[model samples]
Target: MIILGVDPGLTRCGVGVIEAGAHRRLSFVHVDVVRSSPDMSQDLRLLAIYNGLAAKIDRFAPDTVSIERVFAQENRNTVLGTAQAAGMAMLAAAQRGIPVALHTPTESKLAITGNGHALKPQMERMVARILGLNEPPTPADAADALAIAICHALRPAGALQGGEREQHLTPAQRQWAQAAQRSSGRGRRNADRGM
Candidate 1:
C-alpha cells in the first residue's frame, strides 16, 4: 500500500510517501518540506500548506494517509493549529476516499525505536535505516511526520481495521498502561525466580 504521511505545520509541513507489501517491506517515494512565507496571515499560510499538500497528494496518489493524532499541550493555540493543519490534510485524503489513520507520538517512537519516548534524532536514525537512506531526512518535523506514518504501519492489523478507532490516550491512560506493564513484568520475574 502507498501511504502519504503528513507533518502538518504552517511554517513548514513535512511530507513522506511510502509503499509497502503484504509482509510490508517499506519503500520511500519522497520526503520533503512544504514551505510558507513568514509575513503571510495564518489563514493564507494554512491555505498554502493545504494547496501544496493537495498537490503532493495528487502526485503521490497514495492508498492511505497517516497523520499524527491531535495532541493536547499546555498551549491551547499550538494544539489547535496543529489540529487544523492535520484536519486540512485529512480533508485532502477524504476527497480521495482513502483511509486515514491517526497515530500517537508515543506509538511512533515505539515503532521506530522500541521505546515510547524516543528522541527526535533516534527516530531519524531509525527512519533512515528502515528506508535504507544515505542519511536521515532533515528539519526534524519531516522526520517526525514520517514517523507518524511508520507508527501506523506497525499497528496490529485487526485493531487498526475491523471498525476499530484510535483513541488519543490521555495522560491517565498512559500512566495506567505503564503501571499495568510494570505489574505484568513483576509477575513474570516472580514466576521466573520460582522456576
Candidate 2:
C-alpha cells in the first residue's frame, strides 16, 4: 500500500511517502516543505499549502494519508495554524477519496519504540530501523512524518481509521475502550502468573 505521512505546518510542512507489503517496508519517496515563504500572508500561506499539497497528492497518488494529531499546550496560534495546515492536507486526500488516518504523538512513538515515553532520538532510530534507512532523518519533522506512516502501515487495514471518524469517537467511548483493554491485559497477565 502507498501511504503518505504528513507533518503539517504553515511554513515548513514535512511529507513522506512509503510503501508497505507482506514482507518489508520501502520508502519509495519522501518530501519536506514543498515551499517555504515567510513573507506570504496567512491566507496566502494556507492556500500555498493547499495547492502544494494538492500537487503532491497528484504526484504520489497515495492510497492512504497519515497525519499527526495537533497538540497544543500554551500557544493557541501555533495550534490553530497547525490545524489549518492539517485541514488543507486532509482536503487534498478527501478530494481524491483516499483514506486519511490520524495518530497521536504517543501512538506514533509507541508504534516505533514500544514506549510512548520515547525520546526524539529514539523515535528517529526506530523509524530508521523500520524503513531500513542507513541514517535517521534530519529536521525531526521528516522523522515524525515517517513515524506516523509506520503507525498506520503496521495497523490492520480499516482498523487504521480515517479522520472522518474522529468527530464520532467520543470521550466516553475512549474511556470505555481504555478501561476494557487495561482490564483484559491485566487478566491475561494474572492468568499467566497463576499458571
Q: Candidate 2 regions off by >4 Å? A: 24-28, 72-74, 156-195
Q: What is the lDDT of residue 102 in candidate 2?
A: 77
Writing each residue's lDDT as its tens digit, candidate 1 over 39-137 gives 898898789888988999999998778887665552565666677778889888878777677666777888889998888788899998887788997
The alpha-carbon lDDT assigned to residue 10 of candidate 1 equals 64
lDDT of each: 0.74, 0.74
Q: Write the per-residue lDDT of candidate 2 for residues 1-195, one digit (tens) a residue.
A: 888888878788888888887765566467566554779888999999999888888898988888877755626767778888889988898788777777777778777788989998888887887887788876666778778878877754454322324423565774665577577664233222211
In model 2, the Cα lDDT at residue 127 comes to 86
Candidate 2 lDDT for residue 108: 80
* Clash-forming residue pairs, model 2: none
* C-alpha RMSD (angstroms) for model 1: 10.3
